[model samples]
Target: MLRWFLAVIGYLFFRFPGAIAGFVLGSLLDNMMGGKTRTFKTSFGPSPTVSPADFELHLLSLASLVIKADGSVSQSELDYVRQYFVQAYGKDRANETFRVFNEVIKKREISAQNICNLLRQRTRYESRLQILHFLFSIASADGRVSEPEVNEIRRMAGYLGVYSQDFESIKAMFFKNPDSAYQILEIDRNATDAQVKDAYRTMAKKYHPDKLQHLDEAHRKGGEEKFKKVQEAYDQIKKERGI
Candidate 1:
């Protein structure tokens, strides 16, 4: 039934590039509904069981939501989103994904919380964490994350079941401040030097990019960026305390 539906969509859009987009979107929808079914076949084996394409769509949708959290989206936010797509999926695929992204952005009625819930249902914790990180990046693209944007992100995090501490840690990575370093390390400012060292080691182990090896390249890269921030925050705290 799914394949037949896709065939009809392909025929209807036969004269337009949307035919390809329809196919990809339909495949993703089928995967979401069918679960574990192979959407593509190859001589090498099977295509990556996890769909980066679907994940990319969710990421862009969330980004659009974050960009519009302040009641309007900026050119800088749009440009950053475009550059993110180009970097992750290359120019050709990015252009294709951008079409879907625009449609999502146009639907201002759709709740960001709803999108986050769907992501939570369909994705793993690590993948959802990466999505949150990307959303923070989008919100901060205009030099700072607005209060509304931060509130929306926090609400989305709660809906996604991301621990409050982890959400704050990810937020601190993009919006740095003196106290943000402590947040990133998940430690108290008044903690003893020994306790601070222990917290840093624990955070280092928890955020190590190696833990995300099972995910796709884009997610692995996100994890690596997060891990670097964790290290930087720990170093900053150590320097401040002269530990």
Candidate 2:
């Protein structure tokens, strides 16, 4: 399905060469997915089995893509990725992964669309949201999220099938515009107090840490932080509305 879809899209855009490229990417996806019957059990539920090594490599590729999106790579951003892996996977494993990432993954030309497509197929929606949040955190490691980085992440959100509202909500967390609280709650500023409360409840459920039990410890920590952000957004809304 992915191959055919990409092939048609490639044909439409770049004709023969585009079609060939799309087909090649499609084949890569096929190999990554392997057998359809494969499954892995997790706390949240069962998901398609994507080997941990492969998943890590693709994830690192995505990280590298984001780090380089704004023309210059920030040491802070690179350090953030390293520290995150160290915290999540422990020192030895993090170092090993970083070795491969630096020597192999970071040097490659990655297709963000291809990586996102694989993740969209293999991972849950909530997991993808966490991934986006992590990417934003990386982008903001140097204390500012550049426009180019935001744009790249937004394109990733589209490929990952994350809703626009959800994307904006995550973006708001890192950007802090006037309507940020409302954006985090996924409601409009004009929403009534009751509507705001309802949105909070919905977002709370969406970002609840329990939903990410299937993920690794690092991601679970991320989910908990996201849940806290939702609560904080709600609190801010309530204070403004005197609710």
lDDT of each: 0.77, 0.87
Q: In angstroms, how far off is 29's CA in candidate 1?
A: 14
State the lDDT of candidate 1 residue by residue for 1-243, as single tens digits: 664577568868783555666667787887676763323322234443435566677677777778888999889999988987887778999998888766866786666677676666666676667778878878888898999999888988998889999998898887757798899988878988988889889988878888767665666888898889889888898888887
TM-score of each: 0.74, 0.80
TM-score, structure 2 vs. true = 0.80
Off by over 4 Å in 2: 1-47
Off by over 4 Å in 1: 1-51, 103-108
How well is each residue in 1-243 modelled by candidate 2, as lDDT tens digits?
788888889999999999999998998897767763334343356656777766777777888888998999999999999888888878998888878877875466679999998888888888899999999999999999999999999999999899999999999999777799999999999999889988999999999999888777998998998999999899988888889
- How many residue pairs clash in each candidate at the backbone level? 0, 0
Q: 213, model 1: CA deviation in Å?
A: 2.6
* Span of ten consecutive residues with least summed lDDT in model 1: 36-45
